[model samples]
Target: MPIDPQAARLLAMLGAARPTDWPGVSAAARRDGFAALMRMAGTPPAVASVSDVRIAGAAGPLPARLYAPRDGTAPGLVYFHGGGLVAGDLDTHDALCRALAAGSDCRVLSVGYRLAPEHPFPAAAEDAVAAAGDALGRAAEFGLDPARVAVGGDSAGGTLATLAAGALRTRVALQLLLCPALDAAPDTESRRLFARGHLLDAAMMARDLADCAPGALDLADPRLSPLRDPDLAGRPPALIHTAEFDPLRDEGALYAERLAAAGVPVRHRCHPGMIHHFYGLTGLVPAARAALADIAAELGARLAMG
Candidate 1:
């Protein structure tokens, strides 16, 4: 199938707006640019309520935002935003959180984990673990059901979520991964086929990985790349979402396969004609909206099973 017309238009618009010299810019500049680009994607749908709070992290007090569809206890999801673990913040993903909370009828705790280049690898991963612990411990205060809690994220955030799930296996209900970057050393055919022109290019991905892990850590380490984990039998059920035109597409699908093979129930969807980060562009693309709805429905159903 060909690329969706709406998605193709979005890609072209983004290409025209994005600076051609973005790759040569400093990390801080690139981060700001990326945030600005996301802000212009579309207007976020209104949710019941959104509040700011702080959660204890491994390093310090981590900033977080809670989005709820209504005022009451409900299933909760500890969500981490995507920016290659280098750029995104709570504000960057506020809209998506709102939509998820509204659509899924689940409270979403969006964590502001420490970014890379400043904190580095295992730092964000550690914070994810700490935040989930805090969220679970304080589930009552947040009006969440501890037994129905789930962990999720997109891109690098997805990597952190997977790590947290493995460490907190049997505790979490499900893992929702959207265009997750699971393989640190991705050598899939999709990576080669969509290496450039897509929203996330090969050069940008390499830079993000380097920034996150500046030290001499093995890329194949399961902590850095969950796909390398030899044992995934006890992890929670997973819902993996991929994009047809994404460089990370193959890896996300592969992770789903591995999870199912390991006896972990999995639901994987590869959206035809979509690209990386389309989850945040629901207002611009009908397909994106449909995908978000499906995610919300799945979350609601899975969490209700508790």
Candidate 2:
């Protein structure tokens, strides 16, 4: 299919906007812009309940939100938001988290991991691993079934989720990824075709990597790019969703292919006519709403107990 008409309009609106000053914008301002994008998601899908909670992070207490669509034990997910690893927070993804819990009848935990230009690369990665371990070890505290706790995220978060799941091996139930940026150095056709003017700015993406992984000589380190990780066997199953027009699409699909080759169960889907982070643009694109529902169905089927 061609680019979705609705998505095209959204792209137009974005194109008309004032450009951001990259490598100079403060992290706080970047986060504000990131949240503003999510505002277009319209009203978030309602869930049964929401709770503010804390999980042990690599450094200290990590503030988190738990969304439960039903009472009693259910499948759980630790979700990370998309912001290129330098921006985004719990509030930014609240609605999406609600929809996940409501749609899948799961307990969804949205992690507020540290951002870049401040906490930097290793910090977020460590927190992600710690949070997943903490959640898996104490699922009962969040009314979750320990055996079904999954780790997932969007964009940069998809990287975090993969790291956490890979670090813990088969203990994690699943790795649910949405437009994950898995390669620090990428040379894919998608990267060249959709490098800019598609919601995600490639130059800005370069800035994000510099901000988050400053001074890092090796980009292929699995901690920085999970796609480089060699030990895929015995890792939990994965469901990776990539947007057809996203620069990060090919890398994610490549990771899925690699995982399957390594004997890990994986499912990769490239949603046509969608851009990066399209799953969070429900208000701007009606097709995105359907995309979320489709993803939710996959989540429900994998976790079993929708």
> Which pairs clash inside model 1?
none
Which candidate leads in TM-score?
Answer: 2
Quote the positional error of residue 69 for candidate 1 in Å: 0.7
Give lDDT tens digits, candidate 2, residues 1-306.
Answer: 899999998889888873666768777777888889988878987787899999989999999999999889999899988898898899989888888888887889999998888888789999999998998888888998988889999999999998999888768888899999899888999999988788888888988899898884699889887888877788889999999999998999999999999998999999999999898899778999999988987897799842
Local distance difference test scores for all models: 0.89, 0.88
Q: Which residue segments of model 2 deviate by more than 4 Å? A: 18-20
Model 2, residue pairs in steric clash:
none
lDDT of 2 at 44: 87
Root-mean-square deviation (CA) per prediction: 1.3, 1.3
Instruction: Give candidate 1 misplaced runs (Cα > 4 Å).
Output: 19-23
Weakest 10 consecutive residues, lDDT, candidate 2? 18-27
Model 2 lDDT at residue 266: 95
